[model samples]
Target: MQAIGLIETRGLTPALEALDAMCKAANVRMAGFKRVGSGLITVIVEGDVAAVTAAVDAGIAAYPKTGGQLVSSNVIPRPHADLARMLL
Candidate 1:
C-alpha cells in the first residue's frame, strides 16, 4: 500500500533537513515538494503507512523543542492502488 503524506513545518531549513533524514530512514520515495505562496512547504512522500508515519514523526521530532511554529501532518491514499487493502 502506498500513501501520500503531507507535512507542514514551521521553517524551511529544519523541515527540509528533518525530511532528508526521515526519507533516508523510512526508505520512502520522495515525490518532490514545493513552498506554496503562503510559506508552507508541501512534502509529498509515497510509501506505506508506517513509513509515512515514521517520516512524520522524525519531522516533528527534528524541530527544536521550543520557539517554533506549529507543525502538522496529514495522510491520504495514493489513489493508484487497491483502496480496500490500502485501508487495511
Candidate 2:
C-alpha cells in the first residue's frame, strides 16, 4: 500500500521533523516531498497498511503541536501507483 499526505499546516520544518519520526516509527519509505503551493507541502510515502495508517496518525497528532491547523491526509493506492509509474 501507499500513502499521500497533503500537509497544509504551519511550521513546516517541525511538522516535517515530526513526520520523519513518525515514518521511522511506522517503518514507511518516503518517496519524496512535493511543493503543492505556498506554505503547503505534499508528503509522499509508501508502506504497508499498518505503516501508512501509523504515519497518517502521527502526522495528525503532530498537527496540534504546530499551533492550530490540522494536517490533512488521504490514501492513494491507485493514484499513487500511477504517479509512481509516471516518475519511472
Candidate 3:
C-alpha cells in the first residue's frame, strides 16, 4: 500500500462515523475494521500519502461529534509491503 491510516475509537458509532468521514474526505479505501475488545474499534484505510493523512485527520475530526472516545489515530506513508499482506 502507498499509505495506511488507522483510527481507533471507544465505541462502534464513532468508529463507523470516522470511517465514513475518512473515506469521504480523501481518495482512500476502507481496507478493514477490527474490534480490539473492551468496546474499542479501529478503522483502517489505504491510499496515497497525502490522501491517507487527510483521511486520518478527517476521521479524528468526526470523532467529537460522535460523543464517543477517540482512542488513537495514525498514518503510515509508504508502509512495508508485508504490512499489506498482514493487515489488508
Number of the top candidate by TM-score? 3
Please, what are the lDDT tens digits per residue for candidate 2 over residues 43-68? Answer: 66677766777777777776666565
lDDT at 26 for candidate 2? 80
Q: Candidate 1, clashing residue pairs?
A: none
lDDT of predicted model 2: 0.62
Of the two candidates 2 and 3, the one with more favorable TM-score, higher being better, is 3
lDDT pick, better of 2 and 3: 3
Which runs of model 2 end up more than 4 angstroms from their true locations?
1-11, 78-80, 86-88
TM-scores, each model vs. reference = 0.69, 0.69, 0.95
| Local accuracy by lDDT, each model | 0.67, 0.62, 0.92
Report the poorest 10 consecutive residues by lDDT, candidate 1.
79-88
Sort order, lDDT high to low = 3, 1, 2
* Candidate 3 Cα outliers beyond 4 Å, as residue runs: none
lDDT of 1 by residue, 1-88 (tens): 4677667666676567667866876867776576765666666677898888787677666656534564677767555566534433
Off by over 4 Å in 1: 65-67, 78-88
